[model samples]
Target: MKNFKPIWLMVCTLALACAPSSKDEQTAENEETSIFRHQPLVTHMYTADPSAHVFEGKIYIYPSHDIETGATSDDMGGHFDMKDYHVFSMDEPGAAVKDHGPVLKLEDIPWASRQLWAPDAAHKEGKYYLYFPAKDQDDIFRIGVAVADNPAGPFKAQPNPIKGSYSMDPAVFQDDDGSNYLYFGGIWGGQLQWFEDGELVAGRKGPTDGIPAPDQAALMPKVAKLTADMLEMAEKPKDALIVDEQGNPILSGDNQRRFFEGAWVHKYNEQYYLSYSTGDTHNIAYAIGDNPYGPFVHKGNVLLPVQGWTNHHSIVEFEGKWYLFYHDTELSGETHLRNIKMAELQYNPDGTIQTINPMK
Candidate 1:
């Protein structure tokens, strides 16, 4: 509605100036050409659900690879492509693509019998860890974790499942205060975890694990502070809730009408912005909060329904501008065809998000 048609033309010129434009100098003698050229920074063909991280001096994107012997379409269930995992890197955040390795795959996991999707990575001590939601041939999806000394990994999965439940889209976080927490799940509920000892055990499926207890993933988003050991819950490790039942020190997001799933945390100055994909990923949404783990106040439409479907995003601020890293179905189709995209996020001076258009 902003008449961004010119934006597309500019993007084409910016994206294709190196190509043979077939323009004649004689016919355009008086014309000034603003031909901007941009190469494709991402090229993990047949992939999506990209989880991006900036490690050391390079930027890495880990996307779920959906390639079958010969499938022609994609749907909500990702019927067209089973899952294979791959990682790609770039010199700068939005420029210079690099290849670290195909670093990981489902076959790398001994206990995993099928699809591997939505991989999240983090750096700890002197090592790196990758957590993902994967499904076996039986179609039952479970959460798994692997490690490597390098950001790019020959990531090897341990012998068991982290959380053997039907879930997808996980994000691992080591908050600003040096707190380590993990968030995952799509429509079901985004659950939280605290890294204490050596094992990443199931904690209170707080607010986001929408359903009451016994449900594998909680119905809403939760914040569980990891115990000193950095693996399980604190002293009384049994109750996953970091606080009390009336939503004490921290509040959370829940219900189908708001904060559906796929959450991320970005700390800007004194406040932290918690962005999540809402309305079933087909149409995404965002919410903001003063605290990292909060009853985030809705910032209003960060993204509306994108081309059919989209979800599992990463957002970070570099320099002084905000850039959103998300995947949509425009390039491939459906959930996993998550072409890693970079877009400018408009924000009000008061720290709230402005309206934005769908990604191309």
Candidate 2:
């Protein structure tokens, strides 16, 4: 669900969190706010290309489900078996329905084989890994791995997948130093990996034109700087735009194309909020960073970009509030019949991140 189309224009110069100096006024450190305003209370009528996790307190939605006319559930690993992949839980926001389905597919998998796209799942240490983007047997699409203990499972797959070439969206993060990171590519630019028990020590590759792209779209991004067992990289190979989150400077040349790519990081209070998905994912843009590898900063406009392509998004807090996991496409207006959604996210008391506009 890399909707891609978003690209509007943002500029927020920082301040109580910027951009709301007048949208109605609130940030004088909290004009006595009450809660839940700008967006996302629920909208996922079918859920598409989404990813979320908050366990225990609730909030679970894995997207890119298939079959039932929409095709692709030959067991969740397509090539035409039909398609299959599911995992749903909705403590709220778009409260998914329809039995929450599959849990995992591709006929339950056997390995080194077939086609699967998108399919992202994460939950470290205790179990669960389902990161999609498959196609071995020589077809080459890259990225695949599976294992489960719960989170609606039945998963298995392995025998292959978890390298690179033409990977699709596969996100699995677990950082803060504890390690474990894997992000994929799409629309045109995306890639990143780091695993251990699941293998694949390290990775990164992207740009047939996508990811903070724009050079007419050949959006090249190539990063490599690992050794601490991230498997590979670092004999000298760097180019994920040099580093923009705090190492500073990065934007590069033609303004570095545009279509920013999807990256998420959240912490607040002491800083570490880096959210992504920009213009070209059907219109959605965000930037912030005390570090997620970004000179981030772009916080001024297009916070959700509705009216057309929406996108793959994530951010969480639930029950305690704070959310942004996304996916849109009019929920029906076509656009691949998109779904998966969430909203409620309004911060400012000096934490930054607050801007919405797509309700037209």
Candidate 3:
């Protein structure tokens, strides 16, 4: 009996020695969770062009709902046949996201014809406003406003689009002084090239063959101050100039730093940051200026190319941490059908942002 007891005790000791340590178990769990953290924020359906914001201690994402339409791919983005907007909310990053389904649709908008593209949201005086761009009956893109009582909304679209609003990707930036500004525009299919000296050229197809001469001043995005009611442009839209260290307008040929689409503005440490996609270059670049309307000096790329052709993003600080919300084609493996993602964004001591590589 004593010999049998020793054998039993020896087996138990060997089993305990081979068992995983608590630290090892914890590390394994963290690795599994990290894999999820890098994946899409919502996978039930495709969502892209995330315009994330922190509202009332919750993160609200206004994204373009990507649908599988058989439209052929083109430089004009004809394949991106989105027709509605959906609002997504999460208590925190990497947490469960709730899809508040179809906040605004094309059929409900009186002036919108088709193609509900990238959208952004803002809160003022206890009301939430959704600002989006859609093509009007004339096939020219126009920005529109919709209102809601809640962040996650079934918003009511205004009967008419904002007066003097053109182009796509409407990003509303509220400055520290309580002034709200609209930053918008995109070239090529977005049709910013069609406007010469602020007037549309009749019957002009593919202006400048899609770009100005290499030495020519690069096209600029438009910025306008919003009215007090947040429904109309307070004045004429002005060029939000992005320039080199020498203060020269970035040349049209410098695709790497040129403004193509997706304008986002956020302030940090009293400096205004203007970030946008360098469209065909597939990088998210930024510029810094002292004021909201800027002759902003170009910084560097905020994000490198992801798995898709288009990369749109928004930056917001939540719970004392900053995050970049962007999109990729990880889920559908198609450019037009993309999925939204979020990652932590960091800044240097000099206020320059650390370049984020999505492939990492």
Candidate 4:
């Protein structure tokens, strides 16, 4: 039998949803409460798949909310029963983060039903955009974008999901030139797929349908450019970043780098770092490339393995320091319930990232 723990935790990834919140409400909540005083991010509520971004001189975290499960599997609505998302922000280093409260909810998006999984955010042209993935009423997974004038927003939902997106873990990346890109896909047969310009670009067969794992590197990550408006894709998806020079994917069997899901793009010192969770779903790894569209070479692990069914993270620079934001089930007795955690990330003089020992 499969491990019940991982499945339980993954179940809450059933949908991705975000709703808009009023600025007055956001201010009221942040001023009234203190966060991260005890560390490990939010403790009062369960949050997972942390995607952190530095916006307008502040660090903001967009994470999935893990609600308690029901009496049984049937009662739980399905695994990953997430219905909404909250934005956490901090203005100063080593100070308590402020909870911006639920910025988006499932009910606000007319097209989607549930399964608010991992999400990412970006700022462009004075608008804050939330990129999320959720199951639509038709039972298909599609990516959606919600926009708000303020980072702490009562965001307005796009009438429909991104037309061609068909996977989970939607991430938005903005290059220094003001161009945007979306990275997504995850464990559907033990492999993840990629989308670009609202089209299917690259995909691989994996350990699905009781078949043996293929010799191909199953979990390779892919990327594509987004239009200036940050609402649509602008180019075709290309397979880059996680493969070897021969164009073969670097497998993890011989300790080679591999991709599972949760692809995050961060640029530092003019070099591109593509970080993601390994196929094991318990550890975070990364690769380096010269550009956003990469023939990225595998560097090494960014996060060691942890005690959870799934691991997700993002890299951000704040106050001249770099940090890796991720999650674990340490505080929760059950794997289905997870909370956000983070650790400082370091880079070698050669521009490679060092492995991180994430807090439980």
Which one is best on lDDT? Answer: 3
Compute each candidate's TM-score over C-alphas.
0.69, 0.29, 0.89, 0.80
Candidate achieving higher lDDT, 1 or 3: 3
Relative to the true structure, candidate 4 reaches a TM of 0.80
lDDT measured at residue 86 in model 1 versus the true structure, 0 to 100: 68
Q: For candidate 4, lDDT tens digit of each residue in 1-360? A: 122234433343221112244667654443334222224677778888988888888888899898864624322225677889899888855668889889999999989987888888889989999999888895557889999998877677898997666667878778877888888876552123333333444433333321225565544555668887888777766655587656666764533356667888898889888888774546677777888878777777888876666788888889899988888775664655888877788889988878766532
What would the per-residue lDDT of candidate 1 be over residues 35-69, giving only the tens digit for each residue? 21112245546556666777876667776765544
- The segments of candidate 1 whose C-alpha lies over 4 angstroms from its true place after superposition are 1-40, 69-81, 136-139, 163-166, 188-218, 226-257, 333-338
lDDT of each: 0.55, 0.50, 0.88, 0.72
Candidate 4 regions exceeding 4 Å error are 1-38, 71-78, 189-213, 245-247, 252-256
Tens digit per residue, CA lDDT, model 2, 201-255: 3332323222332223223223223224333322333223323334443332323
How many angstroms is residue 82 displaced in model 1 relative to the true structure, after the best TM-score fit?
Answer: 3.8
Best by TM-score: 3
Worst 10 residues of 4 by lDDT: 10-19
Instruction: Give the lDDT ranking, best first.
Output: 3, 4, 1, 2
RMSD of each: 8.3, 19.7, 9.8, 10.2
RMSD of candidate 2 to the truth, in angstroms, is 19.7
> Residues 162-243, candidate 3, lDDT per residue (tens digit)?
9988888999999877899999999887888877666777885663544688889888999999999999999999999999
